[model samples]
Target: MREAAVSPSPLSPSPLSSAAAPPARPVRSPLSGRLAGLWAAAGARCALPVAVLLALGFLAPLVAIFAYSFAPPRSFDVFRAFSLANYAELFSPSNTVWLSFAWSIGLALFTCAILAVVAYPIAYGLAFLFGRWSSLVSVLFVFPLFVSENVRLYGWVLFFIKNGVLDGTLKWLGLEGAPAVLYTPGMILAGMVYTYLPFMLFPLTLGLSMVPRDLIDAARDLGANRFQIWREVEVPLAMPGILIGMLLTFVLAIGAVSEAKILGGQSVIVISHDIEIAFTYAQNWPLGSALAVLVTAFIGALTLLVFARLDLDRLLGRR
Candidate 1:
């Protein structure tokens, strides 16, 4: 139409114009900087005490033991002279050190196996089968933990001793002359199992509890049988807990000397008892220290092995 063009007014703003952008925050306030510094300082201050305590109480002893392991026999001083005599004697073919190690380690392994078998069923029952009553059952399982360890082991002692509670009960039930189990290897193993059962069971229960119900349902919907579901789905999921339980049970069982002493009496000679004898009666601090170092190293190696097998992210459900 070629209408006559008119010039735009200078004072009017355009409707299509965008809003002004806010200014960028290029720097933090001084107060915020000071507060962050204070927080870091406070955390460091809090951690200092614990770090110092660990260094003094834990690291110092380990250092002393390691130093003493290199010392000569009958010497408490680690700095008097450095020698390999103790280690040489320790690994000597004539010594029974290896046998003692085998005995202690074998017992610990056996105990771990038993605990695994027993704990799985208990954990499964608590987490799956028991349902609403699981909490009550858990409390009952943990009730024994409230009692002193020594007292619990002593109770086992009373139960296993000749004519003690077990024998008395059996005789009362018309079973005469029950065999005494006290001070035997079997009794020691049984005591260890009773004492450490909770350790294995609790972890397995926690693991089993975390297994997805949806996964189980899906498995069932897929026509998977109970055993198949458990073996293929449940077990793989609960592996972290099983490994943790195994590690804990094995470590505790292996290091246990008091249980062996009280339950095994003079019947079985574990590496721990041998170390005790070397330390106290034989006055051979070097030998004792060497054995202690060996055990500590062995445990460290086992821990590394366990960590190697564990997927940390998967275990924590991060994956």
Candidate 2:
């Protein structure tokens, strides 16, 4: 109203010359700077022991196995002379190793599949059936490990022998005969299933317990049938346990020499047996090492392919 000359707005900073001015920096004390440095140092120091252990555990053993694989067949004393003769003999048709390995792979696959089917129901019971009995059931499943592998194998031997349970049952059933299950591949699979069933069950129970009941119900309400719920909802969610159990069961079963040697009557010639024969009976460490390495490489490749194909995280769950 007075018509006085208007001055620049007091609150507005002049952008013409002040555009280059920096904003206020965060305040930091010398003590705070020292503390930041100390925190980083502490973290690094804490990590050192773990790093050392990993180097010893993960790297050292792998390096030793690699060295052993390439060692000379004639003498273990030789260093890095580089020979493929052991590998050549390994793949030879006369060895029966290829056939043996194929059989072993078959047994492992069959065992894993059976265990998966058997364990799913048990896990389902533990998750949905047992309730207050869940802890007892889980304990019962784990309790058998205290029996020892040798004892477990021996027990199967007793059960499968000519006059064992099945034969006894046959005698009672008026058939008066059941062919001996002992020393057979079927016996081997039974033992495999008995021993490793708990592995699949425990993990699967853990997986199932994690999946909410409401989620299953919601899917069902939306027209998801029992098969669809399992295939789409339950399986996807429980994939971590299933995949882990499958891998463990398969890998361990494929490497099984004990069940075959002890219960299957040593008639079974598996890859593990091949490795053993090369070392024990043949006294050819180099050949054994090479065969071992080859089998290991094959399994390692298969595991990688399976994990990649399945998208491992789907099994691991969303963290």
Instruction: Quantify all predictions' global Cα lDDT against the true fold.
Output: 0.88, 0.83
Give the C-alpha lDDT of model 1: 0.88
Residues 182-211, candidate 1: write the lDDT tens digits: 888898898889889999999888788779
Q: What TM-score does each of the candidates earn?
A: 0.86, 0.83
| Candidate 1: pairs in clash | none
Clash counts for the predictions, in order: 0, 1
> Of the candidates shown, which would achieve the greatest TM-score relative to the real structure?
1
Cα lDDT tens digits for candidate 2, 195-293: 888878877887787788999999999998999999988888777677777888888889988888998888888889988887788887777777777
Tell me the deviation in Å of residue 304 in model 1.
Answer: 1.3
Model 1 regions lying over 4 Å from their true place: 1-32, 172-174, 317-319
TM-score of 2: 0.83
